[model samples]
Target: MTLDELRATAAARHDTCAQIKKMIVSRLDLPIEPAWITDDQPLFGRGLELDSLDVLELYVAIEAEFGVALYDSDMSVFGSVSRLADHVNPALAERAPTGSA
Candidate 1:
């Protein structure tokens, strides 16, 4: 890919990360800014300390916001924001209209 293509891909990933963080905070009612979520920080346990119910809520929110249907086998990607983005970006790309950057 050209440098421009690489830049575009990076920008799209960044946007998706921000959107996911916002959805997490809003759907979970967390008192945190989207920017406060680091890409590699865990979303559960000692990190954000979310529980199973929170994960369920987040799943619902993700489906509603991104039109992606995640399955039980896909749960491993929820470990961190970056991992979530990696799982989600392809689905988002599929949903994006042709020629949109």
Candidate 2:
């Protein structure tokens, strides 16, 4: 791909990650800014401190917002914002950043 094409792809991935962060914060009513969440930040356990309930909420929110059903997906899909981005927006999978999950 050309330089502009590469940049566009990166931008799209960044946008998708940002959207996921916003959705997480809004859906969960977190007290932090969406930009504060890094693309590779973990979504559960000691990372975001999310629990199983939060996962259910995220499942609904993801479907309503992205029209993607993640109910049958495993926990790895929620490994990180960038990882989630890949599932919600499959076009990014080919160029997904390292350590996303």
Q: Which candidate achieves the best TM-score against the true structure?
A: 2
Error of 1 at 20 (Å): 0.2
Alpha-carbon RMSD, candidate 2:
2.2
Give the whole-model CA lDDT for all candidates, comma-separated: 0.78, 0.92
Q: What 10-residue stretch in candidate 2 is worst by lDDT?
A: 92-101
Quantify how close model 1 is to the true structure by its C-alpha RMSD in Å: 6.7
Instruction: Residues 1-101, candidate 2: write the lDDT tens digits.
Output: 99999899989999999999999999999999999999889989978989999999999999999999999999899888999999999989977654643
Clashes of 1: 0
Give each model a TM-score. Answer: 0.79, 0.91
Give the 10-residue window scoring lowest on summed lDDT in candidate 1.
92-101
Identify the candidate with maximal lDDT: 2
Judged by lDDT against the true structure, how good is candidate 2?
0.92
What C-alpha lDDT does candidate 1 achieve relative to the native structure? 0.78
